[model samples]
Target: MRIRRAGADDAGALALAGAATFLETFAGILHGRDIVEHCRKQHAPQVYADWLDDAGAALWLAETAEGAAPVGYAVIAPPKLPLHDLSEDDLELKRIYLLSRFHGGGVGRELMEQAVAEARVRGARRLLLGVYAGNTRALAFYARNGFEHVGERRFQVGGNTYGDAILALDLRR
Candidate 1:
């Protein structure tokens, strides 16, 4: 696998990866219509293009070595989590997804490491993210990476609102 910075031209690949991974991850846990609608809006190529145009946002794409097929991606942007203390010094891991087949291969960890490095390079003091409260696997992954649950949030997917755990990793370490 190769992980590299994603440019504006990579929006389509990012959208595909985002939607596929989102579906694979939430198909059974979330309502089908909610998942479909959420992916349609959140994973659109134009949404990614807009993010790519933001100077404060950074994205990375992971692809296969064989045919360069996009398999995973990560995005970090200005903090949007519901934290009262948030400021320009913080960043949020807006998204991170990997094909289930790539789960145990360290690709997710690599993507996380890249996000941390990029956030630090941008002078961010903290990195925050919100994940479904029921996703034990993802929660464990974040814990292993030193992220701590700092808050709670209500995340909307289509017409459903679900509980989420807001996690933060101190970048000063």
Candidate 2:
């Protein structure tokens, strides 16, 4: 697969991919209404376009073949809330998703590696991310990829309180 920086022109495809991936990945874990609402809000085309236009952020997409469409993408930016504990300098992995068909096909790993490499290039000493406690598979994936649990925070979704574990991987080490 080939990975490359995504631009504003890719916003629509990115939003579609994000929504599809979220729905596929969180089907049973998140209430259908909640997932739909979250996807609508988080994957809006305008938001994706704005993010892609932002110079402070880095977005990468992985395509399965030469001149093919992207099947997965990752977004990284300086730490933002609801993660108040992380220092301002810490790079946060805001989103990482792959088309369900590409799961376990190494696309996720390559996207993650690209994000980490970008963080290092930007002089970030550590990478931080938050994973819902309910997402055991994702938690395990992060742990296996070198992230360590650093803290926890509570997030309310669909009127239910869920623990979000904070993970950090020190790139300086």
Candidate 3:
């Protein structure tokens, strides 16, 4: 697979792959209306385009081959929320999703390596991500990557509220 930093030109692919991977990952937890609405707003091409256009936000896309469709992507940026107790220099891993077919194939490890490297380059003191409390698989993945559950937060998708566990990995020794 080819993994590279995505530019604004990749917005459409990112949006499409993001929606597909999101559905594959979260379909079990969300109701039909909520999932559809959440994906509509959060995975839109325009949203990704905006992120690509932003100087502070970054994304990495993974393709199966040259000029092929994207199978996965990851995003990292400064925190959008002023969550209590996190460092001012904390970086948030807003997303890391791949097609289920690619699981156990090292795609996620590569993505985390790049994302964490970038976060360190940006001088972040820690890396943070909010995962749905129900997603034990994701929690295990993050734990293996040295992230620990630091707290809890509530996330609202459509009319439903879900509990999310905030995980963090300290970048310092």
TM-score of each: 0.98, 0.91, 0.96
| Residue runs of model 3 more than 4 Å from their true location after superposition | none
Distance (Å) between predicted and true CA of 29, model 1?
Answer: 0.4
Q: What lDDT is reached at residue 79 by model 2?
A: 79
For model 3, how does the per-residue alpha-carbon lDDT over 1-173 read when each residue is reduced to its tens digit?
98899987999999999999888888867887888888899999998998898877889999998668899999998775447877669989999998989889999999999999999999999999998999888899999999987888899886799899988889885
Any runs in candidate 2 off by more than 4 Å, and if so which? Answer: 82-85, 156-161
Q: Candidate 1 — which residues are off by over 4 angstroms?
A: none
For 1-173, candidate 1 gives per-residue lDDT tens digits of 99999998999999999999999999999999999999999999999999999999999999999999999999999988888888889999999999999999999999999999999999999999999999999999999999999999999999999999999999999
Best model number under lDDT: 1
lDDT of 2 at 1: 77
Q: What is the lDDT of every predicted structure here?
A: 0.96, 0.83, 0.89
Model 1 residue 133 CA deviation (Å) reads: 0.6
Cα RMSD for candidates in order: 0.6, 1.9, 1.2
- Taking all chains together, the TM-score of candidate 1 against the true structure is 0.98
